[model samples]
Target: MSLLEAVAMLAYYDPDSECTVMREVPFSDSAHILLRFLHSRNFQTFMDGVPQITDFRYTNEAMLGIVFDDNFAPLGMIQNSMGFLEGGTVVRKSFPQSDLLMSIPLLSDLVGSMLGKGPYFIANDAGPSPFELGKGPLYRWANFDEVGTQDDPLFQDAGGTTTYTTTENEVSDIRDVARVIFKGPLNLTEWYFSTRLVADIVAALFPFGRDYGINFLHGDKLESMPKIEFIAEQGVLSGGTFMFLPIPGERELIKGYNHMDVLTACASLPSPGSARLRRAPHWNQLATTIAIPPLLVPAPAETQTSGVADIMETIEDTLMPSLVLIISYDDGNRVSNSQTGFFCTPQGHILTALGGIRNSPMVNVKTIDRGVFKVKRVMGEERAFNLVKLTADVPASQMKPVSYNRSIPVYGTQVYAVTIPGPDEKTVTALQVTGTREIPGIGMVILTTPSIPAYYNNCPVADARGQVLGLAVSESSGGAAVDFIIPSAVILGLFVGATPVSFEDWEAREMLQGLDNTYAEAMRLLWLGRFTAAAPLFERAAKARPQDADPLYYAAACYENTKQAARAQTLYEQALKADPESVKVLFSLGLLHARAGRAKKATALFAEVVDREPRHAQGHAELVKLYAGVRNRDLMQKHLALLRGLDPDLAEDTLYEIESAGRTRR
Candidate 1:
């Protein structure tokens, strides 16, 4: 059966009705914008290694027409036709032609403003109709053709699955719209398509936004693909989809078998015969293989290295030696923590994240070959960026410091994280550059793949060539926590010819916190396990902002961390008095009371916490523990169910504890 293949799309989503309708192929707002920008000759070069804008070969109108069919004329035929709205008798009409005309000028102005072009040429000069027939396509609901059931011949090979019977009029306001178009394969496997391409288009459409949804689809081949594609409204990066249909008796399908070949290439096993179909694990693997007898030679000694693998090899061979394990010990408790660090200079200078060594009395560095050595001095620091440089007592010969790649990688560039998991071995993770940030004095920090491993913090992130891009550190952006890097330039910017000071002396420097210091910084220190350092900062903030309960609540936490139970209790009480609605403070105070053998008080406080924030998983967990301790089966089971709903993993472990405790009581 001939499956649908070789189709390109220009689509828009109506979030109100949650319907995604195909836009007029080349005349859609995004398609128009992209074509106009390309034809303007303004954008030529992008980041290094990426193809120049001209290489995609779409500068000319004829070349562009090969990929994009004018769906506008067909859509205009039914623009005046009436359609029913969801659960409404009102007949709504869509004037796609008029809507498309109005949006072009607005979009043109936006592009002209951003590109510094004085009145860019309007690609489509079709003015809006003076007489209003119906609503613009952007505001109206989408309608579908009655193409019969799923068993219809139209959908027999996934050909007519995505067919849109009607089109919405394009609107002038394109803020909620995401720009999208399908590019043909660059060669065979890779396409000219990348997030950078989509991002640039989005930037033209919306001058200021980074959290907009972008979906990427890359595959070798597909046929009768049974899946639905979602366009995210808020997601930054999402996957894409591909469909392939092999027309029966087509010469291209017989001789070249490009469509069939793509599917076979993705298969896990060798093709049994000509166009043999079989079940496989991955989506790409759902294919019939073209079977042919093979004259097999001896298996090749080595497979060709991919770009990612080559980058990883460079990291393992060259960068790993430069990385050292940093162990920091707290003053009184000698509580030690280990994080990754790397040599930054030939003089045995090491650079790592500040949070790791913030409140440590002593810090030690362990190298692969040189063994463990004490950190002699703090060389430099950028507190805001959470980066610090240190001088260790290691020999210069043992320090294979990685040099900086001065040029920051553009968004979508590939980066590698080199993490020293042990003294003798290392783990390398390849990450994609999502975006970047330029901090004043600190220079550019490269944001990469989301949710970096905690152990990867303070590790060195390098480019494909083994040049250090930056030191890996986690930062919260757009309300989602993602890891990024403080560039080597930022690390170098820290050293302003100032002489190094001993760790003890640097610890004293933190005592000079002033009015300029922020409560957020104090909270950060607290999060880093530097309770002693955070306690004073929190107290200062509490004194400065008397009405705020956060400072008092966090200060109490700092005291609790440092084992001053009474001071913690007083502060927690004061915080509660300041903000009775603060569920976290209530929960904390309850835990303190429970610790002091006040079970009834803890139970009451925990109940109040659950009441205030019903989804408070930790509060529910605490109640379960308390009820289990008292062997109160019914209450324990109730809270256990709640905990299970909130955190199944925690509930499973808690269930184990409750059963074990019951056995002990019996």
Candidate 2:
């Protein structure tokens, strides 16, 4: 007899020795399908008789492993409970889970009491998945729990012939593998922590933890409490608040962010690893409540938003909150005009129009959300540009400050004009670049856009891609449609010492993200009127879309808008190199040269555009303006005819061109 047959005979004392052998056929796809169908039917039949106690669903994931054996794994450390082919670390990789499955509702009731202090567990069972239940839990915390002795007998089951007292231990032994072992409350209110709980958790589940409840506000940790208050009251750091769990060693228990961080660790555990299996928190619902913005802003659960809603939201998040000061000045006689002042520095400095304040030492200013601060002092001013820096009782650290970009705006770029037109209306108008004027010593061409107005004078102009391009001045030269912008380069240079950054150097050195979200956000913030806030976003965006010209264009615009003309000029040059045929880019490049008093280079670029597209009105108009500056009347008239032919109204309103014709030639 075969060894297998002999072993079966020895173990069972012969398995139907006289049984007839059945002939087996080759398995086909249809046979496999039939077998699967039969197996499923059998499983269902067996399960139906088992009497459902609970849905064996999991909220946490685990690794499949077995007891470590040295014979199979010879090269290993004594402390290594488990080892895989690779040992590496992931930094802030795993995100909070989404779309928790709808539950039939069973045994996870005690899970809340098992984990330490945080209430996230009670709320995280957050009902059902949006797809299945039509709506997920808005707040995961439940209102009530079960009472009395009416518990399931399955949960009350105990092993090894002994019925444990309290029935809690008996249920826990079964549930412990799927939930955290309770270690009591962890209050953040005091300096002292219960080290006994930590020791117990470590002893019970070595090398890792499930989750720990933590307190916020009243029970805030002494070390972390001070920093958050400094921000909430001072406004130094922006975006979401992040604090780590007090886990020591190379491995952290889990990094916690904001108040919700106290919920679950969500760390991956090995097989048989003790844990508290709770549903992952619905992070998308709670991102805006934090100090720093998260990487992935959750999309709407039901319907998609048009681009406008998203832009509005980004603006509200970054700028609206800090635009607190209701700054008003008087032109003598009870007539007072008011405009909003934005925080300019982290130390409470405010930048507004020099003319707006009218150099008044004392003005009434009210915070956006707080009480007013009077007797504000004028810290400094760039009188030449009508810009002023003021100091208020309020510190910049108490509010979000506007960040500046090193690049400047290009000619004809679309921008957002932030102004107050009505008593109750905080207006943001979308405007387009009308023209550019070059002036020596200013370092950048004066940006003229149709978006400027008398009431909006001294207000900020932001690019469509999200950078404050310039501050609108009252002078439009002579063109009725013109709003001359004090270029961003001159602005930055006026206050902060400006340094021009090269595209190659910036792109080569700056770290980039795996996705293009930074680029997307910076572009949107343009309309939201947060130039300073948009600068780093643009930098990150620029670094991310190195191959795309638009991101660079936006970043460059930020510089030009902030008055860093030279930096903006270089960035535009790089953009033009990337897209040689871009007429708009070419025209802006020429405008930059013209602003810096380099008419020859400016002339070449304008000539290139006008030569290629005779119908291009801006190109023809720029050439005429440049020619007029150098007394090249013949060249001027040649393009003047084209400008008039392409757009008669624009040709007639050429006074801004005449006024900004450039310095007289030697």
lDDT of 1 at 497: 42
Q: Across residues 517-546, which tens digit of lDDT does each residue of candidate 2 receive?
A: 465455435433345555567667666556
Tens digits of per-residue lDDT for model 1, 1-666: 000011211222222431222121223455544433333322321113122122221112212221221121111111111111222111111221223333474553333222221111111211233233222222222221122222331211134344322211111111111111222222211323246665655553442322222222222222343333321111111111111223222221112111112222222212122122122222343223332211111112132125445657867898888888888887674747888888888777888877767667788898989589988888877554567888878977788978888667765566777887755444977666766764321235676664466567768888878898877875442244445677776666565544578877986665344324466576556545567887888888888767667788878888887799999999999988887887768998999988888888999999999998888787898899898778798998898899999887577556655654553344
Model 2: residues with Cα > 4 Å off, grouped in runs: 1-313, 324-335, 359-361, 395-397, 411-413, 424-426, 446-449, 463-466, 476-481, 495-666
Q: What C-alpha lDDT do the candidate models reach, one value each? A: 0.52, 0.42
* Displacement of the residue 269 alpha carbon in candidate 2, Å: 75
TM-score of predicted model 1? 0.36
Instruction: Quote model 2's TM-score.
Output: 0.28
